[model samples]
Target: MNPRRKKRLLFATVLIGGVAAVASLLLFALNSNLDLFYTPTEVVQGRNDGGAKPDVGQRIRVGGMVVEGSVERDPTSLKIAFQVADTGPAITVLYDGMLPDLFREGQGIVAQGTLVEPGVLEASEVLAKHDENYMPPEVAEAMGKEHKKMEYSEGQSGY
Candidate 1:
């Protein structure tokens, strides 16, 4: 091939290779950082209903109400374990860090971490509702009709 044509071909090859490399890097970053939100009911049912359960150690987010009377603290360490529940089911979460001041039972929360097993989440981050009336949109949506039932029950009990 002529020198000019050879040079042009080399340039095109390098450009294509660079583009592919960048694309691959972007995909990998996205896959690693993408955190999906699931409710406790969905997590439990997904494990038992022949649906694909999240692989252990895969990053994810779980959203629900903190189950009343489920909070346990080590007192010595920062480790805390609590159960989060949607209207249907509950999942236990273990976290070893400072919890938000607003974190409390019966309040809405989102825990982000990995699924350590079928019923437990090893949370790295915990987010609580900022206000009494505030609930994460994703949590509300995932709760589905169960939210209405909870509201009805709470109203009846005068909570």
Candidate 2:
């Protein structure tokens, strides 16, 4: 083989390899930094931890019921605080942004952000009720169970 031809072939091979490497790197970085959605159960069950630190500025979505009487807002600072519950544990959320119109006490919400401190989540966005009579399946199911219990007790008393 001619020396010049050999040199050209080697350069072409290296250039192609370099391009492929760069593309792979970019994809990996993007995937690593992506924020993923998780329901309250998933979050508490460690399903969406992805081996990433839950409180180290990693973007995430946490869905749960908004605890009744836990919603509060500061008119001056526009800061909002609320409690999100999964029927197991509750997480406190702090956000400084306009909340969704459907946000209210005793409703379901999906907060997107990172944990700013232990047991305290700082949300960048807050997603509230999807529609009238619609709630997060988790919250609705929990409420249903509670309703049944109460009804059963009332029936027993009457009997």
Candidate 3:
């Protein structure tokens, strides 16, 4: 091949290779940081459309209404355990940190952490609705209360 043609081909090859390498690295970083969301029922069973459940040890965010009378705190430590449920089955979440003030039974919450067991999550962070007027639309809809707000005035559980 001519010298100029060889130079141009080499340059093009190097540029394409560099772009592909960068794209792969970006995708790897994104995938590692990705956290999938699932409902308690979806954790216990598969999705309604038969999607596979989150694998054990995978990072995820699960949101649901805190099951009434399900919060249990360890007297010796800051660790707390509670069951989060949607319309169907419930999944237990163990968190070892200060829970948000708004966190209470019958309230909606989202826990971000890893699935340590099939139906359990070891939460690294727990988030609760900041106000009565605010609820994550996704959580509300997943729990089968699309338009209704969570009410606990009569000592009832939102789930």
Candidate 4:
């Protein structure tokens, strides 16, 4: 190969490698920054386990059943508060935006926001459960024991 051609090829290879490295770094950073939410049972038992609670301003997503009657919307503002449950305790979620169409009482929901305090989620994104049987995998696992208990109870009742 010509010397000049070899140099050009080397430079092109370096440029491509640098671009790839930058892309990988950006992807890693983004993934680390993104956070997900979980139900009360999940929080108690630690489904998204091992990581410390996010800093006050970091984003997160929380999923659970909306407590039976805990939804309260502001009369004039977009602020809304509700409790997310999973057979154990409930986490209070405060959101300040228009809610999804499927958000309703006694239904499943996933709210994305920041954890302003322990057991309190300040949500910026409120995602209602969209499908008939779509429960987050983490939420399902957290509720597994409770579901089994219900099954046992039903068997005993014979209905």
In order of appearance, the predictions have TM-scores of 0.86, 0.70, 0.90, 0.68
Ordered from best to worst lDDT, the candidate numbers read 3, 1, 4, 2
Instruction: For each candidate in turn, give its C-alpha RMSD to the true structure in angstroms.
Output: 3.0, 4.9, 4.0, 4.0
Per-residue lDDT of 1-159 in model 1, one digit per residue for the tens?
A: 999999999999999999999999999999889998888987887734466767777788999999999999998999999999987779999999999999989989999999989879999999999997889999998876768643455438655
lDDT of 4 by residue, 57-104 (tens): 656777778998899989999899999987877889998888988889
Residue 139's lDDT in candidate 2: 50
lDDT of each: 0.89, 0.74, 0.91, 0.78
lDDT of 3: 0.91
Q: Model 3, range 1-159, lDDT digits (tens) per residue?
A: 999999999999999999999999999999999998888999999888889999999999999889999999999999999999888889999999999999999888999999999999999999999998777666876766443654688777777
| Residue 55 accuracy (lDDT) in model 3 | 94
Error of 1 at 31 (Å): 1.0
Model 1, stretches more than 4 Å misplaced?
A: 47-51, 149-159
Worst 10 residues of 4 by lDDT: 146-155
lDDT of 2 by residue, 47-147 (tens): 44354335456678777788898888897998999988775667788999888888898777888898676457799888888786676664565445542
Error of 1 at 16 (Å): 0.8
Q: How close is candidate 1 to the true structure, as a TM-score?
A: 0.86
Pairs of residues clashing in candidate 1? none
Q: Any residue pairs clashing in model 2, and if so which? A: none
